[model samples]
Target chain A: MLSDLYIPGASALHRMRPAWKLALLFLYCTALFVVSHSLMLGLGLLLIALGYGIAGLRPRHAFDAVRPALYVLVIIFAAQLWLEDLAMAAFVTLRLIALLMAAALVTYTTKASEFTDGILALLSRAPKWLPKDKIALAISLVWRFIPMIRDQFEEVREAQRARGIERSLLALVAPLVVRVLKSADEIAEAIEARSLD
Target chain B: MTTRDIVLIALFAALTAVMAVFPPVTLPLLPVPITAQSLGIMLAGGILGAKRGALSIILLLVLVAIGLPLLSGGRGGLSVFFGPTAGFLAGWVAAAFTIGWMTEKFWDGLSFVSATLICVAGGIVVMYALGIPGISLMADVPLSKAFMGSVTFIPGDIVKALIAAAVMVTVKKSYPIIGQAA
Candidate 1:
């Protein structure tokens, strides 16, 4: 599910260089916080939605992209409501949603290979004493492991549910750790066998 | 570090990121949701030792900064770094380092109880110390209110701490990932 967000399309964004897409994301993220007026933020949200459209995405794509963040957004809005006024809540919410949508537009349009390549390129230029290759490998491993772990968690939960036991972290965590460590051992063995180091 | 060290670091870092994918348990009153990622943080510290555990956490944050939706609830990117949750996210690094360092110091003699104590100190106390101020500043809330609100996290974190300790002891008994101090 982690990599499934990128819908394949030949939109101009998909055609743009990965570096340029990343640069645009950076610029938009920075610019949104700098211009925090409600009107500007509202316009930014509209612009980002338009960006999704240009990237051959429908309004539904934008909503789906933003949906995961809705829980956090509601909490922030509620907190702001308690502390400040509706305008402040609205401003913060819009600012966040705009920034998130802009990022998602890039994410949903960019291919995984391009994104990984961009990351590798960026890390290659890091100062000496940092293990850039190792970092890059770790990033790729993160992507690979996310869905695997999600699946493992679901399976563990299902087994526990079938047993009719109470849903508890204690019941779920130990087996998950054992499985994760075993998989890590296998991954390490594979890397060592490949002598990729 | 050898190739083995690098692999362990990467594996634990990936574990931490994967831990975030679990659905969060949200308490209705508190803004912060209870998550299992902090348990992963404590386990990384206890299992991987000090420097390696901290490095793993830094690696995870680096990925988050680069716009991977690796955080719980699929939140990521630099925008999250500037949001109300930034402090807690930053605290992950410190918490991991503190717990790992303590675990390393007492590596041979540490029991599950003491390891759990370290987790609470680092993962809960240190995290709140950083996170409360972060909310007060970033979210524009009062420190008193933020501290009061964050109390809800304590019970959840205590559970995570105990679970992390139990996992570490069990894994050590079985697989023994961390080497003995020379």
Candidate 2:
């Protein structure tokens, strides 16, 4: 998810340390929480957009950040409108948008290595028994699978469509289960082969 | 650290950080926002086992502690624990331990369903236990009222549990015996 953007060349926004960038992100979010005024939240949202532009992220990338949650936000806005007022709705949505882009820009630019090293550096205070290597392996698994899961999701859909059983939960989910088991077996066997012991 | 190890750790941490930022589902009845982040927590436990899972989460929380806007709604920083979600945040550590312990406790063999249940309990129930007290104190509502409000999250929690189960199965199939040791 962090490496999806194709924007060429590193810019200053991308160059900011992940640690400092995270600090700014917190400040911006806190500002969003404090700025109850819609006009002001709107300004914050615009500022986040400017940050995105500075990071050299395309407008489409920003849309990609909010697109999945777009419908959900609409429902949330409608409910907030019913329970609260229009201004509150506007404020809430702006809060959501600003936070999303600001975070997206961070993930969009910061390399995963920076994130891990940043973490290892941070965790130096922990007890000596903690196995940092095992933790690193697990993190690698998760990172390795982000795109893999999405790809499998599509592959499942395509296979279902071909099988003419796109409508059934049994059909849709069964393959996912089967594939999962198959993958687990393969992973286990691979571990056995390497015989790290 | 090996180059490969660095890549792996970074990837999982990023996966979790992304999940943490994932927007919560808004149900009409509940004031609390639900998200898929908890499942990520469970997955951290199941796939990484306890030590690694805990470490990955520690890394994520460390980012938050240091003031990264990595939480849901783009909220982060040490101050957030003072907010409504602090309990859930703290629960991540406990939940990871529970998941790892349960998944590895099979003396007979790998009982995927049993492991899944244990992980789910850690992921859902333990979190609620921690989170409710947290919301009770932070929101300053009666414990029961705080609980009643959070009960709305059960439906979402169940979904997260099921998804965690599915993902656990995936891990078993694709990457069984996650580390070098069988």
lDDT scores of the candidates, listed in order: 0.76, 0.62
TM-score of each: 0.81, 0.53
> Model 2 clash pairs?
A135-B52, A139-B12, A140-B8, A181-B173, A183-B173, A183-B174, A184-B172, A184-B173, A184-B174, A185-B173
Off by over 4 Å in 1: A1-4, A125-128, A143-168, A182-190, B20-34, B62-69, B74-83, B179-182
lDDT at position B108, candidate 2: 32
Clash count, one per candidate: 0, 10
Error of 1 at B60 (Å): 3.4
Which one wins on DockQ?
A: 1
Return the TM-scores of chain A for each candidate in numbered order: 0.76, 0.70
lDDT of 1 by residue, A1-197 (tens): 56434678998888999778778877877777677576777777778867888888888876765677576577678888988899998887777677667777776776666766777887788898987877777777767776777788788889988887525666677787778777876777788799877
Tell me the DockQ of each model, to 2 decimals: 0.40, 0.11
Runs with alpha carbons beyond 4 Å of true place in candidate 2: A1-6, A116-197, B1-53, B56-94, B100-120, B127-182
